[model samples]
Target: MVAYKSKVVERIRLPSRERRAAALEEAGYNAFNLAADDVFVDLLTDSGTGAMSDDQWAALFRGDEAYAGSSSFDQLTSAVADVMGFERLVPTHQGRGAENVLYGALLSEGDVALNNTHFDTTRAHVSNQGAEPVDCPIAGAHDPETDEPFKGNFSLERARAVVDEVGAERVPLVIQTVTNNSTAGQPVSVENTRRVRAFADEIDATFVIDACRFAENAYFVTRREDEFADATVADAAREQLGYADALVMSGKKDGLVNVGGFVATDDGALFERCKQRAILYEGFPTYGGMAGRDVAAMAVGLREAVEESYITDRIEQVRELGAMLEAVGLPVYEPVGGHAVYIDAGATFPDIPADEFPGQALVCELYREGGVRGVELGSFAFPETDRPELVRLAVPRRTYHREHFDHVAETAEAVLEKRHEVAGLEIVSNPAVPELRHFTASLEPVSAERAAAADGGSE
Candidate 1:
């Protein structure tokens, strides 16, 4: 890949080790609490963190900031139609906004929504609506050591079980998260999507594909799935999206923009309900919650995201980082998913248990070792639930280069070398944090006295 623009070098502010320790203590050991200026390499998230291309930047001029029926909204709708085979659109501020808008319309109290795997926000939104969000990912999804190409595929068996138990009327939606984020960004196969569609049809539930990383998932389908081995990225994306009754996308991801998301459907009645929710919760149908310029940029980004070259390079860059970590004997999630590299923190630090938050311990150590910021995607992210312990280093799109990843790999190695020294964290207080406690929860290192007492009691 070649650069379309000149490299803009910004100084990476590297704080001293002592300064990092002080910062960690002050922030209560939460990486999200750390200042961006203090981080040398920030891999906390990919959402709204990528650099926009020249075309997207130029589209900003086309924005028409009107209260209704803006030209930018038209551009977005046209792009969605052309790229995703959808007829209607309801724009939102981001992915979660789209989820809230869509779920708020379709779901009622005691309703059930099934997914291959529900990321934190989607699960929280479903819970907020008093609906149950059930995960039905295939067994392969949970095995980080298994190199399955389509680990993101839904478990049809479990899906059937849930449907049977809940009865079809109580089940309103079935979602497939492309490149399932909770399970290491793994790609879902076209065949699996077709099966999911059939199952959704049988139960009369809406089949919604979460299109956050749709392009990346398509690229993987082209490379891995034999049926679509010769298909273009756009064609593969159309095939996958074609099976869905509706789709919810985060423009921050595949859109390649700083902020935007949308829910699209071909069903006119469903579209109207989504629009009502969009207006009630977000904004007007046309502008929704995003700015006009952001709408225009998302239009450009949606098209750009499906380009063969761009999608290829993006997935390969993520693989390159995964390879680097594996070279150092790190327990990386196999097949090196689409958008990020997930480390098996539970395996890395076997001595630490889920309640103590091994993933958070490793996340803290990565920052202290070399100022590299990664997020914990495990028990901490899904507290009060039994989940695997993992650390996700989500690389932003076209933002960091080889050198940055090299530094990240080196930093990970440094932390691994001293893994025994890492200490678990405990929530300072139970004061009502959000359901997604990982975002704003304050934690401190488990005190030696407390640790000893717990160990003695266990013995």
Candidate 2:
């Protein structure tokens, strides 16, 4: 096989680590890319799906096709409606656009958006459309790498905080199920969801759910946690789904297939408005915003996603990996929830100052040395000042094996061997014009010349 190089002759950042430091040539680095055949685990993105027989997918295809192939958007919407159990189905071109376009029509400027956490795109979209993204996660309620169950539900106090700040009339709250991405991938509790939704109603605020990792979140709450220990996974998921005014999920995560997302709601007006925007960006109101095969795949994926066995195993797996990382002496987040394992880069490289963007440095290091390309959670993904530094390792559905996890453990140990080499990132510039740009930050360099000097190689 033509080999992909694994060694890093230069400094790099390890994603989901302390900081995005530059790994020195002296650090004995290797890349973490799967293509390089070096990385053993991929816990950077929640893109995993349970495996199935070809017949299963084919059965979904029988009911749906990959492309519309001249099928009307209404037909698409009907299929989606049937799949999601909604009263009226409308699919459109809304996912790729900003939160403003999707929500601006329903909300005015200065409106409040409350959620346990905000995915990068959703936050950018909401802010671009003139709404404020308010994140109030529950207290110490989660650990992402160990499947600790639901610890990330929004709080009644936090809800009251929103009502206190924006008043009930102008504020609408959003609840994200499963991993509270910004808060270490924690799952929100069903009880928390019930309370938050009830509070929103009390204050006359609309409650929306972000179901990007809903299935994984369900696994944690139903199969793992004490409160939900008696409930079936599907029952818990349906209950969570029932609490929201509407729910939107990223297509790549639990929704089956690698493409398409859905926004479910009972509000006819909201549905109408979202469909109008969806047609502009996605396609038509009937199909919302998806292609044919993906539509079929998602239809099937959604059905399978609700199954307890499929989701439970996947959610548990991430926790298992996180526990493994913790066992090896890495400072992993406690109370694993769903999807990713967040590494405390700040804790990992405490000697490295926060100003240095240690998490960024760590991410770069992991990539260079291990060829793995997980994303950085520090300011690289969110604002560093507002939140603590972190490196996120998302686990895509059905993407890796146990061996991959082992490789991650290996790279982590190797990177720790050169812990002193990790450095923090300094933001060079930040502009907020386009909504999605919020995720990737531009930064100043750190590890190059210092490592050269340390090794007595070159300046």
* lDDT per residue as tens, model 2, 188-252: 77777788777878877777777767777777776556777898776677777777777766656
Off by over 4 Å in 2: 1-42, 48-85, 92-101, 141-149, 224-227, 428-440, 447-459
RMSD after Cα superposition, model 2: 7.4
Query: Superposing every Cα of model 1 onto the true structure, what RMSD results?
Result: 1.4
Task: Give the TM-score (vs. native) of candidate 1.
Answer: 0.97
Tell me how far the alpha carbon of residue 55 in candidate 2 is from the true structure, in angstroms, after superposition.
4.5
State, as a TM-score between 0 and 1, how close model 2 is to the true structure: 0.80
Report the CA-based lDDT of candidate 2 relative to the real structure.
0.61
lDDT of 1 by residue, 321-390 (tens): 9999999878999988999999999988876767789999999998998999999999888876555788
Q: After superposition, how far is residue 398 of candidate 1 from its true place, in Å?
A: 0.7
**Per-prediction CA RMSD (Å):** 1.4, 7.4
lDDT score at residue 111, model 1, on the 0-100 scale: 96
Q: Candidate 1: where are CA atoms >4 Å away?
A: 2-7, 430-434, 457-459
